[model samples]
Target: MIVKYTKPGRNLIMVPMLILLTGVSSCASRPPSSVLQPVRLVQNESEKITLLAITNRDRESDGKGFGSRWAAKLTYEKYRFSIPSERKSTAIVYPSKNPDPRRQFVVTARKQLLDSELIDDATSAANFDGTVAVFVHGYNYSYQEALFRTAQMAADASTLSPPILFSWPSAASVTGYVTDRDAALYSRGELERLLGALAKDSRVKRIVLFGHSMGGFLSMEAAAQLKLQGRRDVMAKLQIVLAAPDIDVDVFRSQLRDLGHMQTPITLLVSKTDRALTISSVIGGERPRIGRLDIDDPMIR
Candidate 1:
């Protein structure tokens, strides 16, 4: 006769069984699309736009150093801009000894667009007829990468009359995350200076500020600073668009509230499948803030 073996207690068996089931189910299911895809912005519609881009020089150099020079090499290929070799002395003047050369380059590009009269100027409220789109790029982007992205946006939103970019120092480096954060803070003053200059132009009626990844945090800070300085008057002239911002959802909302409840309409472009943001979240020891929550989240709402 065979002897009957005694069974383990329910509590011990249940937990292990559940875990095994969960593991099997997870293995059976496909991973989320965002897990497999890269993060990118989608531009559609709107016309007569100006782009302001904030770039990270340190990021560009890092790509070069690491021999992954995709940002530097592929910048111009993706966007249409007059290369230095193709540029005339009258077309644009390069900055000399600027603290942030990337920013200077972006400014120079904007000036070229303005000088060419390819896009209208925002000089008065009555002159506001088109869109002014400003882009603040995220971490680890090189100078060329930023330029190309700006150009690509311009091309994608060809209907926008004049696009301007606002470039900020990102100090793009993997190990320099802290330094980059500090740098972004340091550049707030410059952003404020730029906003002051833009607000004086009455022609700027419909302004769109687009900030991506970490750039979103910097953009929000800059906007808040502008509001505190009574520069909120410019809010009447603009719309704010944030894409995959790297700040905490709560922080973003609080800042908006402090800025007079976001006097202007705000749009957030979000993608849950952004690997970069995922990595950012992990490093920061926080949950990822995806675009899906932009509407329902109380903080952003």
Candidate 2:
């Protein structure tokens, strides 16, 4: 009886309902999922092979160029038993190339990658001293930033000697965090290679490696690789210093364990005020490692 009373409007309602049903059915009949999209894996190979020649205008301004030459000459004269006048004469002939201001000190540090001589020179210096300090930079740092940081650290720490900078191409863009991380990882193998080469020189006293932010992870990875190679003696020469490392504390600890009783002392410089590392911790979905412990924390101690 109700159906008989139903008007044309009621029939029209069914038309709209049918249309909706058809639409839904069409949508449902389509592929259940989007086609798997291929993701491009960015390789940090570009940064790995890079070598940057460091030159600074400020070195001249600060008289570091003159001082370095003087130091070199003085050492050559006193230690090598050569005449100071002869060494000074040679230094004058070389004059350290006026400390090339255009030469990149930090950003595109890979320029030296092609130069075996430069790498050899660095390695030679490290081996000669029996100790070397390698500095790695964090995210968003330019070549200048690396150079300035290295210089500052070298100047500040009297015991921190023979500063060598392993500059990775950071892109130095805040938005390029992923790229920067990839680059840091990419260059890790190179760092390992460098350390391995240095280790061959028994003359090397110790290797003090300093890394800030992502550099910390790279340093850890490099050290771990060195340890795994049965070169614990080389690892013994490694003193790893991490400053506001952008790494999961757990992961970092695991890396340390992998290093397995390195004679090299590990030190971390963490400050709760480190804003960059704090953001990294949040993105990584973990507690801020820097805030979780101080230098004297039992976990670290």
Candidate 3:
């Protein structure tokens, strides 16, 4: 089924860095253009899968395409998505698998001119429950990694709600940690725009904001921004989940004080064995990160 977008609302100002589209092929026969890769691919075995992603990384001019799978599929063989550091917001549809090499397969792809209300309309139309889970990735993640992770997590959860990925411009390298951290901070405004749109949409009944590692920092920041904007109605319908958050204990405590007691439940998932956090602790002058807290400590109690 081809999903189309209606007119976008006037208030939607946040630009979606990437848009993904997915549809099923009617026949089992392999497409003539299908090239077998040596390694196993995620979703390679599945006949149909739902894919949705938004990314802000610079586009590549090479044949490989953008960080998003659906965007890569939709982009022409040249594989261009967005320009390097282009701030113009865009939304595009996924390309269907086509067999003919001679004919262009991606010409039919179109931008999803959208606003939050339009997004809610589409989500409401897709599922009766009207729940949308937004997943934000942490530091050192390439755009593709974030996209695939969200897809896999959503599949594992087996939820009726659609999964959306909000990927910042992470340097995607261990050495780039500092740069990624700054990028994460810079991304707060964009995140706010996205969350605000989703929150304001009437058709959206529930929203789950999930973040991993440094992404947790972004999530909490966005949550605080929502509260500051007097968008408690939006916060009321949200459920915040932070997994292995890479946040300073002091910062976390401050965020809590500002948020006060929230109507929405916030679930924090932490583990001592998280090596990344272990290294982070060392970098931060031996102070324990929030993700690696000691519950027995009186301060924690």
Which candidate has the highest TM-score of all? 3
Output the TM-score of candidate 1: 0.58
Task: Give the distance in Å from residue 240's predicted Cα in candidate 2 to where it truly belongs.
Answer: 1.1
lDDT of candidates 1 onward, in order: 0.46, 0.47, 0.55
Model 1, 1-301: lDDT tens per residue? 1111111112321111111111001112222212111112122212223443332222323232111121221111111232232322222222233212222222222222322132234332243455556666666544444444554445444433435555555444555455656766766776666555566565555666766667778888988888777776666665666665667666765776767655555555555555556656777787645332444456634
What range of 10 consecutive residues in model 3 has the weakest lDDT sum? Answer: 17-26
TM-score of each: 0.58, 0.57, 0.67
Best candidate according to lDDT: 3
- For model 2 the local lDDT of residue 273 reads 52
Ranked by lDDT, the better of candidates 1 and 2 is 2
Residues 142-243 of candidate 3: C-alpha lDDT, one tens digit per residue: 655555445445444555654677878776666666777788887787777777777677777778787777888998998888787788777777777766
Give all candidate RMSDs, comma-separated. Answer: 18.3, 26.4, 13.5
Better of 2 and 3 by TM-score: 3
Off by over 4 Å in 1: 1-130, 287-301
